[model samples]
Target chain A: MADHEHKDNEQLGAAGFNRRGLLKCMAWAGTGVLWTVNGGVPRSLGLLGEAAAAESHAGGLTFLQISDSHVGFDKPANPNALGTFQEAIAKIKAMPTQPAFIVHTGDITHLSKDKEFDDADQAMKALKQKVHVIPGEHDVADADNGKAYLDRYGKGTQGRGWYSFDAGGVHFIALINVFNFQPGFKSAGLAQLGDEQLEWMEKDVKGLSSSTPIVVLAHLPLWTVYENWGWGTEDAPRALGYLKRFGSVTVLNGHIHQIQQKIEGNVSFHTARSTAFPQPAPGSAPAPGPMKVPAEQLHSVLGVRTVNYIRGKSPLAIVDTPLSA
Target chain B: MLRTRAVLLGGAALSAMLCAAAPAVISGGGPALAAAKAASVKIDNFNFTPPTLVVEPGTTVTWTNADDSPHSVREMDGRFKSAALDTDDSFSQTFSAPGQYQYFCSIHPRMVGKIIVQPAGKTSSN
Candidate 1:
């Protein structure tokens, strides 16, 4: 299996494809490849043919990630943002085996209006699985400063809607870094986890063994992607220090509206695509905003991510499938 | 400073021409009448145009969002703040004190700007 994966990597290199180019090609193809991790390294197992079979045989845990469903957005880039969000939900409903749960990493609403939140809630009700969510800057733009989002999703969460949970022997931590603009706070134009949350997180994982797999979810990229565009977190490095001892750590975030992945030691960071619209690559455009594309090519840039984990395996298999695919 | 007045005058003339019933204050107006009594900043492409503006005290500064994304104008010291402004929305704040007030978009904080308020009859050093 290792040799086969090595050959595939060599072939991709020979084709002159960088990592981002390879991901864009995979996204354009819409066939969706499956990734398997051995030790701390990840390898693609070609397409979904063998990956699907391996998933059923292992039958460990599968979960879905959908993000940036700006419900009230009506720009030229995508006039029907809510329509596309519903389409993404319909796609999830059609899957042969429903994931254990769904995690929406924020931007659930465009302007945090009551109608927008209502519309989002009604659409998400169609799915059978429960959804865990963190707030994006767009979701907390209400006049009262996040009161609307908290009233709906903050029943048991602590401090601006951050919490942790465990499923299938893997620990999951949901964080909120989009609160730099809230009253009584000052930040350097980037998302922040804050010192209070960092303290909570340090205690949250204190008792866990080093062997336990850790998964982190947040609205903005925990790692800095583009400082000029405010696409990264300010205090994430301090939070990451608390999780350094974990054997396998996977961090999932969504704010840039595109897919980006990085690996450092035992940690793998991933940003999911938005269901609403796409943004230009870092430094690719004058600034980051809704990027207008040909109507026919829109679906190729927007999609959903599915992650499967097998106990005792150090790596989680992640697959990104576009809407049209 | 001359170019800024020209652009404002041009905009005022265009608006006056578009609206036949509008007041005739902009037509044949001199430079004094077109002075920075009221200034405007445009938010477009995630940038605050006229990143630095000099105006007399009591001048009302209005920010207009032209981008499809939502943005808010917030004073760094919490002196003033505007709610989220959607496309085509406008927010105005009157600067009554002669001081420099730095602000940024609360949503996209990298987009920063400054409004320099000068005392009456005094030219702005900036």
Candidate 2:
């Protein structure tokens, strides 16, 4: 495998970039899971040293990130959504340091059925912890109608489903971009925070100090993943512009299903993994949908990321460690 | 251990009744299924495409290589594995039993999918 370390400037063709060892990029096969690694090293994120662990890190926070947990989805690609989701939770519980809270980026359910939500909810219930949620396109198909998912999960959130909270002196914002969408943009899939919510988000963070650590969670990549497939958000530019001033901003999204990252200034953006099944790389397949794999080895993909916010002069650390590892 | 579902539809198997989605002929609805058309799934970033699929019993589910890279289609217990299929190459398996088959690219287990197999010669439940 090459250096497992993901190089910002170096680009791996969306598909079949030869990687040695376990660092190889996972691809979509028949009815099985593929583990695809970019370059070699899965991003070597910096961890905060001393001073921050003693709780004196005041605005210090570490949280678990789980995305694309497509519950109620029963496919050869991923036969067991509940089990994988549990595995993901187990990874979260086994974290070296327990995060202050948990964030589910999106795709909590595959078909977005009530039972699917319940299944995901059941798995989460075992954690015995408070969870913050942001809806993905799968969860908010009926926004034009009262069936908007925000109504069910958007407690104390803003706009259709965007909301902000304060923890450890840092401002945590969750936005809903699955609202308005355009055609051929299926990659980013259709994220919209409604004008009402976007306006509110601007005002909500207007007064916060640029130094305060900000964690933003949405469903789609705020940046571009694959322009051909619309693998990025249409309106994220405006949203990022708002956070550009913040010295340490961490933006997280879930739509891509793969882990891709980029650091633009103080902002570190990451895409999360799904608790359900894995998808193929953009353009690697004919079209986007549930990918199939063999029946076994499904657990390897069930991983979680831990983000630790430390005080002092150190920047916040985000780790995408897989549960299957 | 990975899990697979084996659901017995409650209603009669007469008409092809699709549920929760469009009234299309097929696309993984109900406890039933259909044969899968050979296709490729996207996995460059970290997701599956057509994340769900339903096929009739005995349908050979083939995952082809559409990208320049190589990939596999294997089961959880090492029950199956596809030698890396290069670009344009393909792999296939016949789903004979009526049950849910969840699989992933052994190379990249995160690339997951589900294949719901239905009882042969049946569709809707009334």
Interface RMSD of every candidate?
3.9, 14.8
| Candidate 1 local Cα displacement, residue A191, angstroms | 1.8
Candidate 2 A-chain TM-score: 0.80
Per-prediction TM-score: 0.84, 0.61
Off by over 4 Å in 2: A1-60, A142-148, A185-190, B1-126
Provide per-model DockQ scores. Answer: 0.27, 0.02
- Model 2 residue A302 CA deviation in Å: 3.0
lDDT tens readout by residue for model 2, A51-109: 32323223456677889887765556776777888888887776566788898998787
Question: Each candidate: what lDDT?
Answer: 0.77, 0.58
Give the best candidate by DockQ: 1
Backbone clashes under 3 angstroms, per model: 0, 93
